[model samples]
Target: MSKKALYIRHKAQPGKREEVKRIWEKYARAYIEDADGQIAYVYGFDDTDPDAIVAYQFYDGEAGKEDFVKQPWYPDYERETAALLAGPSEFRTITPQWIKGGAA
Candidate 1:
């Protein structure tokens, strides 16, 4: 299957969800907003898990994701995020064969 979307579920260390959100807002938000081929990007806290942050991104194509790690702010964002995370994130690749509207 061809993948055009990504979902990341990350659980922050207890009481560190705010730090994780700040890191994304300070770094990743601008990059995603300006990135080429990015169709949509959104993130928020999990309804049942106060320590969890979930992110969903829709790309125009697979090539759209190539620059994520290459961005200048990526290192700082990654380091800060990793420090606050309870553990490794869960990545879910999606095949967008039935997309209908913009992401929330």
Candidate 2:
């Protein structure tokens, strides 16, 4: 089966860009330490909009993605970051065609 990927775009509330980044950093660390079936996870701010943050998470397969979302930490993450966001996040599910060099 092909890998499953999730793309999330977050617009930070005013003056909350750094806080959002920090929160993501902490979450990523904990996720890496505790979760399984993660192929790759990448996150960064938009070049044109500092307040905009984007994250791409690749999993082993559909089941892997489902397992990740079902983890107990997922809800906690959502709740912790809710107040820092400007609005609802944009999400997309994808199938990776190819990944070239490391993300820049």
Candidate 3:
């Protein structure tokens, strides 16, 4: 079964949104190009609320995600961005029984 992750981020701080995006961009290459099971990724900010950004990322399976997260760069990315973020971020794992998009 294929698995996916839905990540929602809300930036409570007024001036930190740009920084948040920069961090994501810094790690984008590694996460998308090199990470295991990473099928696709889409991210954007709310028009009415720029402080809010939603990311939809799909992985091949649970094991792939686990392996990806364990990569050295993953922790480095997390640690560097931890202070730039606001409150707790949310992560939802989903089993994509059927996906309409093309495969990665």
Candidate 4:
């Protein structure tokens, strides 16, 4: 089966870029240990805007993506970070058309 990917674009509230990065790092560590369906998680700050951050998570497949959303920590993560966000996060689910070099 083909892998699935989730893309998230987040804008941090004023002066919250560092906090957002720290929280995301904590979340990534937890996800690495416990996310069964996740293949990888990548995150970074936007090039043009330091307050904007982007994250991507690769899954085994669409079902894996579904399973991820159902995980107990999902809602908690969303709620915990919601207050630090300048607005709602932009989310997108994508199918990999081509991949090269790296494992992703």
Candidate 5:
């Protein structure tokens, strides 16, 4: 089973979605290209609500993730984004223990 960390944001306003997307994009790219042991970082918006932004981050291990978050760029971005964000963003770390048969 692989481990993943999910970050969910239920946007408070429609206008700020673009800015949020840009921020996520920047961070996601950095995670994949610069950070060590990061498998992938993907994000998207809710189809129905549109106000929701979700990020799925796959890591080689938990340690890799811990190091990634502690990087200087990450905290700087977080601080700058605090006010631009609507509310508290929800965070979860998940381990994929099982998979149903399916094709995408």
Candidate 6:
């Protein structure tokens, strides 16, 4: 099966960008690094929007993505992240058609 990818765009509450980042690091960064079937993960700020948080993730397949989100800790992550977000997040699923260097 083809790899599954996700693009997430989030707007943090005013002046909460750093806090959002901190929470992500606490909840997800190391987890993604060691997850089975996860190909890559990227988290960073938008170049044009200081309050925007952007993330890209690549997984071996849809199930890999699902497994990641189905963890027991996911709800805690959701609740915390939601509190710092200004509004709903934007999520997009992608199927890769080309190869590139690994995520940094």
By lDDT, the best candidate is: 6
TM-score of 1: 0.89
Local error of candidate 6 at 31, Å? 1.0
Model 2 C-alpha lDDT per residue in residues 15-103, reported as the tens digit of each score: 78889887666665576546567777788888899789898887777876687667667787777788899999999998767766623
Q: Estimate each model's TM-score.
A: 0.89, 0.80, 0.76, 0.80, 0.74, 0.91
Off by over 4 Å in 5: 10-12, 99-104
Record all residue pairs in model 2 with backbone atoms less than 3 Å apart, i.e. clashing: none
Distance from true location, Cα of 76 in model 2, Å: 2.1
List model 3 lDDT by residue over 1-104, tens digit each. Answer: 65666565655466777777788788765567776577777777868875666777777767666775676777777776677767777777765656677532
Worst lDDT window (10 residues) for model 2? 95-104
Q: What is the lDDT of residue 3 in candidate 2?
A: 70
Task: Evaluate residue 67 in candidate 1 and report its C-alpha lDDT on the 0 to 100 scale.
Answer: 74
RMSD of 6: 2.8
Which stretches in model 1 have alpha-carbon errors above 4 Å? 1-3, 101-104
Clashing pairs in 5: none
Write the residue-wise lDDT of candidate 5 on 1-104 in tens digits: 24555555546456777787677567656566777666666777777776677767766667757786777688766765665677888887777554355211
Cα lDDT tens digits, model 4, 1-104, are 67888999999998798887787666555765577777777888898997899989888877766765676776866777888999989999888877675443
lDDT of 1 by residue, 13-60 (tens): 999999899999999888888987777888989999999999998887
Which pairs, if any, clash in model 3?
Answer: none
